[model samples]
Target chain A: MLSPKRTKYRKAHKGRIHGLSTSGTTLNFGQFGLNALQPERITARQIEAARRAITRHMKRQGRLWIRIFPDVPVSVKAAETRMGSGKGSPEFWVARVHPGRIIFEIDGVSDTIAHEAFALAAAKLPINVKVVARQGEGA
Target chain B: MANAIKLAATARDRAGKGVARETRRQGRIPCVIYGAGQAPVMISVDAAAVARDVHASNFVTKTYDIDVGGVSHHVLPRDVQFHPVSDRAIHIDFLRIDAASLINVSVPFEFKNAETSPGLKRGGALNIVHHEIEVRCRPDQIPAHITIDLAGLEINASVHLSGVSFPEGVVPHVSEKDFTIATIATPSALRGKEDGEGDGAASPAEAAKA
Candidate 1:
């Protein structure tokens, strides 16, 4: 799983994703990309699962880039805990992904392989996604 | 010089988000033609036609003869905005140009002789720094696409802008530094093996296990 090695704060507030992403919306390093269609908090485990799906489908032939990182620490309270206590310890990391963000990018793969790989990866994600191609590169 | 693609367009009376949406509902894309010191003309072109051209190679550098109602305007595709979810062409900007117009355009790079490159044969990845290079040239002299020959490039070798030969009268927009366009990068699997040989350092997986 992908997580930050160091941080200034141990835990972060649960932020709301309001609008479409302003950046990382285009395919920068690859011919095909997986674009998010809804806002969600993607955990590190989900990202790893999606990455494994993509790489396994591609047979590790092409290169893959994870555009988003799990930097926001998500804290959780223990079961049956009282409400008067303080915030719980950091449990896991997540990335706040807004709509229209390119979550994954792949290169050096055929059109059929890229689409199939993205389809396999999308099943592991919580949000709706679409396969996108670089302009003038794929159908 | 490449031949101009002819497209039929109609002059539009309004310009706004609502009007653009309405045009899209009618299976037409809202486009504006401006530049060359002339007033901007709002027009609507067939959505399917614009989508086809947008997906074609060298869309920005390609010249277009858009026939607006009756008047034909010589223009170049300045920009294209796509719908976020559907990946459809929502809006397009066309810059009017003439024979003497000096325009700056980003030309796509078409790599050649990749099989002949020693680096590529060794399973090295061609890391492209710039998919397109901005160049200033006349509308008539704009190259379709810049050819990058990777015939004898070796592992770790880089192709710089200064080493590329552009067509006559076509000059790179950036001249201050010799910017690297692409490089033959060593594969991560090979890099790990080389690092282990140089220093007896354990790989990430081995370190994690420890």
Candidate 2:
């Protein structure tokens, strides 16, 4: 659903998501966050679904930042076609989320409210999630 | 600061997704050099080179002499935006710098003499509080890394910023308070285990979690 308008002709090999992330490990602009505990390719559709769930819970109260963007082109062969032809054209887009990557963050709301919001969002994903608060300053 | 490294680029006429995609197609990263009271200039540099420079350990502290067309402009890399999924350098932002002006930068912390510390000799781990510190220094005075020696530190001892000697004319941005840089901390559970008692069981809470 979030395919880039133009892309390179050749396909790209799937790369490994290893080690802890450096930047997204901290909450830059949010109170509560959803940190990915496992490395997985989060589909664009899943990101959209999680964002919708978060905003729906917030109901326009707080700010939300989606740190990762779905830019990887995921190619899939047709369901019923016979195998062993050529690589399938780019099917959709996905974001490779690694451990410690903050998938979602929310601010401008109470701790319980943000916690509840991210919980609703996390239920839509396919990886283990940890809800963390911003470090230092105050609770 | 280390001498500014040379970077080669060309001025671009347009700035947009269309142009950026086209630039990436040619294996060059689209970038903008601004922030010196002059209008922003769009340019493109070798994507592979950008990737290499960005991965350098001291990328943030180093200055660069970016050659835009035939003219060279001294600049610092302010930001490098990578494609989220592919994790490749897609855009770079450079800020023009004057060699004489005082600028703020975060320099990585380098600790020394951990081997001689009494705490470390007793199986304590060095817990770093700040991996890097923000300091205001001239473009020429930025230290590659701030070094702190823990030669005489004991268990639970911490070295504050005031204890370390920064290069002359380099002042910390957090001068209002003496902040901690690192500490020699013993894992409390391991501390209990090393108490000479044969019993070294996990605490109740830790056991429950396990």
Candidate 3:
């Protein structure tokens, strides 16, 4: 099994299954929706709101967690190298937005709870919990 | 059998590495459409448009309504070519899927549940052994993904290829008992506890009996 860290590293330095550049991009292929996730509609306020909601949800859910919201200085390099990726932000400009499109990554949980959490988020926010890519040992 | 996506395409009169590079420079991707008992034909497509659709999960099976030299054809992705350096699609292979023909394709796995699983809650990590599995099905009955609800799976439990249920008229080519698709074990800090406890109890019991 591939760890999320190894997977990201493989995607960055080695190559990715989607065949897209990892120079700055995270996901290259797989099922994703752009229905309302167009780049133009994102706003700083909405990102902040989503960040707060997700962070609170993670804390309330009772687990060690990390958050990566849009315009939070989350570089592909940082994601490929660092475990937490980066930090939170409230004043960064909105890089992109779609009403319900988001990337939610949860670790150290069961499939059932993960799914439920994903469903809950999807229902509450304009985002989709596409898939989970876990890391290997020490990842 | 749900929504079938269609896109316009064109057959290329010129073929070769140079032609392909030129096509890319013009914001087009080189592609090929074969199968249906016909010879392989080279083609090109709008790079941006295909990229958006390719980002979707079931890229290959989705019917692309392509127009090649004003001729319309329904196609599915078969193979992809990427730039060695850029990793962007340089060439694509689309097969003209026949309604009656059974084709082999790899479908994605969508795992559900994370926040509520006992294993995950206890710090056990979920590791997907297979991201996609190959199955035989008609073009129209192609499933977008092989969704598995990981609602109550314990740590070390797996969802194998045999466990995957397909849509009507779809069947996995893998024989019974074949160990295919799966989400298996990735021991972490949590597993250490189990290992410690298991060894401690077993060793003490064996020593006392001796």
C-alpha RMSD values across all candidates? 3.9, 16.0, 14.2
lDDT of 3 by residue, A1-139 (tens): 0012112222212212232222322322212211222223233444334334433443333222222223322224333455564442222233343222334344434456555544544454444334333321110
Error of 2 at B121 (Å): 2.7
- For all predictions in the order shown, the interface RMSD in Å is 6.1, 19.1, 16.3
Q: Which is better, 1 or 2, measured by TM-score?
A: 1
lDDT of 1 by residue, B48-119 (tens): 876777866588888999998789999999999877667788889999999887899999888899999998
lDDT of 2 by residue, A56-75 (tens): 67654545677887778878
Clashing pairs in 2: B1-B140
Off by over 4 Å in 1: A5-10, A55-62, A109-116, A135-139, B194-210
Q: Which stretches of candidate 3 lie over 4 Å from their true place?
A: A1-139, B184-187, B192-210
lDDT of 2 by residue, B102-178 (tens): 88887767777878989877756566667678889888888788889989899889998879898898888975488
Estimate, for each residue in A70-98, the C-alpha lDDT of model 1 and write its tens digit.
89999999999998689998999999998
Check candidate 1 and list the clashing pairs. Answer: none
- lDDT per residue for candidate 3 within B1-210, as digits (tens), equals 555565666778888889888889999999888888888888888898877555455676577777777777778888776443334677888888777888898777667776666765664555555666778988888877777777777777777766767778888765556574544344434333555422211222233454
Best-first order by DockQ: 1, 3, 2
How accurate locally is residue A42 in candidate 1, as Cα lDDT from 0 to 100? Answer: 97
Top lDDT model: 1
- Of 2 and 3, the candidate ranking higher by lDDT: 2
TM-score for chain B considered on its own, for each of the candidates: 0.90, 0.83, 0.83
